[model samples]
Target: MKALFDTIKIYPKLIITFLIVLTPLFTLSLVMNKYGSASVKSEITNSMLSKVHFYNSTLENEFGRTIAIMREFARYDDLDLLSNRTEIMNYYEQRGAIRNLQKELSVIKNSSTYIQEASVHIPSIDRTISDDNFGTIQQDEFDALNVLTNHFESPFIYWQDRLFISLPYPIKSNRQPPDFVVDIEISIPLLKNALLQFTNHTAGNTMLVHFEDGWRIGGDEPEGFLQAINSVIQADNADNAELHSATVDGQKYLIAFEKSKTLGTTLIMYERESTVLGPLDRYTVWFWMISILTLIVIMIVSYSVYRLIHRPLRTLVRAFRKVEHGNLSVAFDYRGRDEFQYLYTQFNAMVQRLQQMIQEVYEQKFRVQHAELKQLQSQINPHFLYNSLFILYRLAKKSRDENQIRFSKYLSDYFQFITRNSSDTVTLAEEVQHAKNYVEIQKMRFASQIEVAFGELPASYVDLTVPRLIIQPLLENAYKYGLEEKETGAKLTVQFAEDQADLLIRVEDNGELADEELIANLRRKLDVQDAGLETTGILNVHRRLQLQFGAEYGLVIAQGESGGFSVTIRLPRTTSM
Candidate 1:
């Protein structure tokens, strides 16, 4: 995944990161929204269920009171006296008995608001007296009456296209089966009105279902409403006050129902999903709008960040690219206050320093080549000329000298060796021979004053290449500073040995030091290049050793084993020269 992301450009990468970060927030928002809606729905369902239960109890109590009134009228002694009146009155002329029955029902009807009519039946006279102005019974109600319980309340019944609650009580005077039946009718519209009052402020419908006849009261049913009712009934959850969810006609609803045991009706309260979830729908739309706006803002922020960081980064890359191609003069032009600006300033400084260093190196190289060419052009072997002229002049003045011819031959041989300037470097054997010729010339000058020793070197080491004039300068320094003033017993030794990866050539002189600090100071000067003084032969030899080999191979001064000053020349065992 990291490699895949690395291949992507910064803009897309930032966009993808925003998406990765936003996914969880979007998910959380959706989850909380759904949870909030469900919570609200549950609360509203519980509230509606509570109201349904309250209304159910109210209906139960109202019907209970109606039953109680029916029971009271059935047990009244004055009303029961009508059961024996048929034996005293002729069937055609009992108008006074009928009037008394009507007066009694009228008094019962006026007692409560629920009662729609009241009536008493005489089987012997085949007559019924009622408080209703019609004072008659339809054939279907009469036929249904025969099948009802004589001393109990009946289920809700339809009569004349209107629902009614009937309570029938059989009157018995002498242990006979029944002399007459008393029926009390309470209007169902009053019950519907009571249900409607409870739901005036609610968002849904309230209803009562008659279990015996599948009749519904209190509200118009929507499409598939009957199916939803059937599902509730099948679940046998009519006694439960808990709310249920159902979809009716492709529209969702919350349904809560309760059964009335006394009335054989189930009270159902239902709310459509759209109505109950209206606020949630709006909230969802608003949330989406906010999420879109937030995404837009985040995108803007991402673009801004890319410009702030990426453009500067690209500039750095381009500057480095120029430097990589050897354009050391390249520099950044940024002048902002952020960290990148600091980096740009530092980068510019570094480039300037690098350019200066490179130019110094080039100029130093040019100076070195120019000096070497000039030295080559002016080379005339002055040491050989001075020594040869001195020896020739001294011999000419002393013509009778015994060593005159020998010295002349030696000087001729020395000039023959010294005058050749074929290469800047030569074999160790050649350098040793050149030093031997210089020593031969110096011996003529200080023959009896000092003793000079040249140590033996291996033939394999003799062929190694080394800088010319390197050994002769140290020999000259030893003779000039440490041995020239000594009258006798002054010794100069030139010895060669390999020291690990380096080769050492020690030139020793057993001479008293007037100032030991002088040697120490000279050794210190050899350690630094461009010491800013006229280059002595020894100092020139030390610088050449380092320039050819490195800083580690140079010259150092120490006391020799013979209690005299020793100059040690260190050089690598292998050299490019």
Candidate 2:
């Protein structure tokens, strides 16, 4: 898996990542659309139910108000006084009573638009007073009124052919049967119109179901829709006030119901499911369209990025691989005016600089090897010259020629000592022997004018190796620069001592020129790091000692006792000779 991902290009990687993120977002949008659709349908049904409840409440209030008005009319004092038979016996009193009753009924009828008629029947005179003259009552009308009187405090209601909602108030004298009945007839058409004004149903039906009498107030409903509501009303436990769902006429609906216990009526509001959730379906379609467009846009952008960025970066990666393999000559010459172009230009310049550095390093190594070969050849030439001189010195010694013998021996020994350059380093004893040979030669040249002495070194320090020709130069300098200038013969002494962890070899000479100024001059020259061999001959020996051992093992020049110049050669005490 890891290898497959590593081989995939940058463009594919970005597209894969975008698709992975987009998948979950698309799923969440679909889930939200479904949830929002259900929520919208529920809210619409609840809102319609709220309006139905308002209408029911208004109906209840109107019914209560009408019943109260009827009770108020029953409290008339004239009706209470008419219980006496004497008031109906006198012709003048009877005539005054009938006129007063007519005027009161007229006033009651005029008080409300819902009241169509008002009338009072008296059994004693077998006569009825009314707010309007509607001819005469038939036998069937009288029988219906007689049966309705039996149900006390009930409204006289019927909806077959004609509509009526009347309240019958019976007047009882001295706890006997009612002396007469007062009826207030409410206009059914006007009441139905008033109830319909509160309805807001778009599809489906709204009804005020009077369950007690099996009559509904709202007009014009489909038979199936009406049956569905009536079935729920007839069901014993259908008093639940919450909105519910039902199917009627092969169509889905959301139903909301509220039952009024006081009026024995139920308020039912319902609308078709498809109609209520119609907008949600439209919204879902729109959301899917937008989502598809978004995916298309992402695809277009991914392709553009692959061309502009990923392709150039891949080329840079290839260049890096070449550099890793030591090929600094590789170059990237991307030509467009973008960030990658600038980076490629700089990278190509860097490769050129790296190539130059590589060439310079190779040339430096060649020069170093040449110098080492020349140094070896130079050592060989000196060894051949010194061997010939050694042979000539033995021939002179055999002849017993003192001057020639002395000169030949010293020259031969000096040449042999300096020319034996098999290596740059030798033991301290060998270095000291070379120094004594050079001093003897110098003594022969100066006669008894310079006296010289050699001191014995410790047995333990004799085998330490040091740079050859280091001590002989100091001894030669003491004779040519110091002892030769003095009138009295100067004493030259070579002494060895140990100071701390080093072997100190001191060469001191007492001469006229070995004063404070000469000692200071010699010390100053030894202190200089870059002094050349021709300018500072003694300083060259000091620098070689330092390079061979370390900075601590070097020559230090100073003043000795009673006008003598002392040069101390410091070397590390090492057992590896």
Candidate 3:
């Protein structure tokens, strides 16, 4: 069975495939069939009990009217005098009294709908009369059925074509003697008429059968019903059996039964195996068809999905495999415009970039080694400058030349600033001091030709971090390319201020602004691997800032307000300062 089901997993578009999937559904049908039979039986029992209640009510109503007549008759002024009367005929011959009492009795008897008979049996006169004589019961049964009204139920009741229910009550006098006995009878057909009110025939025929033994109410099955009832008792199952069935020859009869615990009795109801399960059979057929269609649909869908998506991705895998095996010339065969296709195009571009970067590395290996040598060469740079300043100091002291001393001190401070080699990044305050020292050093060479003005230092922004030598290079570029060209007092201003959501540091000079073509070419060179130290510094600062604070905070270069172009360094409001 497991192997058969596994075959369904492989090829699901066949009848056996549905047969496996639909087995649970068939089991559910059998379960529902059982439930339906039990449900119908429960309803049948309720129907019969309900009918029995209606019959009891009808009898009460019929007998109630006869009682009313007797009550009215007892209220007469001469009614209590009946037991003490001397003679029977004399009591009737009591002038106009008998005639008047009989007339009142006649009106009371004829006024009721359910009352078939209303009569008084006078023990003193040994006589009995009724509105009508429907039938009579056997003497023994009548004697057992006649009891005082105080009892809840009587021991006997007669079953005939006419009245199926009867009750007797006494009418006593006040002389420690009895006045009469009142008898009432209710017709059976009248009660059965009320039983027909329940329109649900699937429940079964409802009837009230009050035998001499006891009463049996609820659902009437045709036959083989007793055996099912015997099963209920034999099992001693307190909870009702949901459904049971019996086969008489080739025909099957479904049965459902429930017993009322209070009445200490059983109720049996049966419906046909076909009638109760009609809807279930139809639904099962429909579900079988749907299961077949579902199996076919899953197989078709799985195939279609594998072709559209997995096949295209498989092509990409082959291209990567070829690249892995050192086939550098192999390219992706991309056909669609999706993420996978975009990756294909990007992979081709990346391969070209990788080849170019490899070639440049081979060419620049000498220059890279030379820069490392240069970096190591500058380690004891301050010591050499300090010895030179020391020699100049001794010479100036011996000769008493104050101007020489001042110049040597300035030189010492300048070399110390250059050779500190503290870190690659420093605060804005440190950068400003470095810039001032550079300006002082240049003054000795290009004396009074260049003017440098420092912007107001904001205490809040002075602690801002910048790459070391970034500002100094820009200042050098300004003097070399901009302010150096001016004849009189070339001016340079380094400004810092908060600009809306950004912090700006503007370096401007009274010099020349490069043309658009130069600016565009410089931008391209700054983007290249073989770019010089100047472009590399700006690109490194910009890329680091972009990596740290994102693309919005980086270098901005443009033509200045007055003369030479400016580089405005932009910073974000992420750090506290």
By lDDT, who's the top model here? 1
For model 3, the local distance difference test gives 0.56
For candidate 1, what's the RMSD? 28.6
lDDT of 2 by residue, 488-573 (tens): 85799999999888888899988666667777776777777652333234776776666557677788888877577788988788
lDDT of 2 at 179: 53
Output the lDDT of residue 489, model 1: 94
lDDT of each: 0.72, 0.68, 0.56
Report the C-alpha lDDT of model 1 over 170-190, residue by residue, as the tens digit.
634555535555666766687
**Strongest candidate by TM-score:** 2
Tell me the RMSD of model 3 versus the true structure. 17.3
Judging by lDDT, tell me the better candidate of 1 and 2. 1
Of candidates 3 and 1, the better by TM-score: 1
Full ranking by lDDT: 1, 2, 3
lDDT of 3 at 290: 76
Clashes of each: 0, 1, 0
Q: What would the per-residue lDDT of candidate 3 be over residues 1-577, giving only the tens digit for each residue?
A: 7775665633343345445676787678767866875686567545544544444444444445555556667566544445346365364455344445456555655665544555444455554444432233344434443444422233224444444223343333543324554554544454444444432455344434333334443344443554444654456575443455665445565544444332233434444656655565676677668767866775676566545665567776787787677666767767878888898898888767767776797567546534433453254435434555565656666767755666666676656655666554567778777777666655654567877777876777778776555566677677767877788857788898888877888888768656667667656754554434443345655554554455677677767777566777787644541
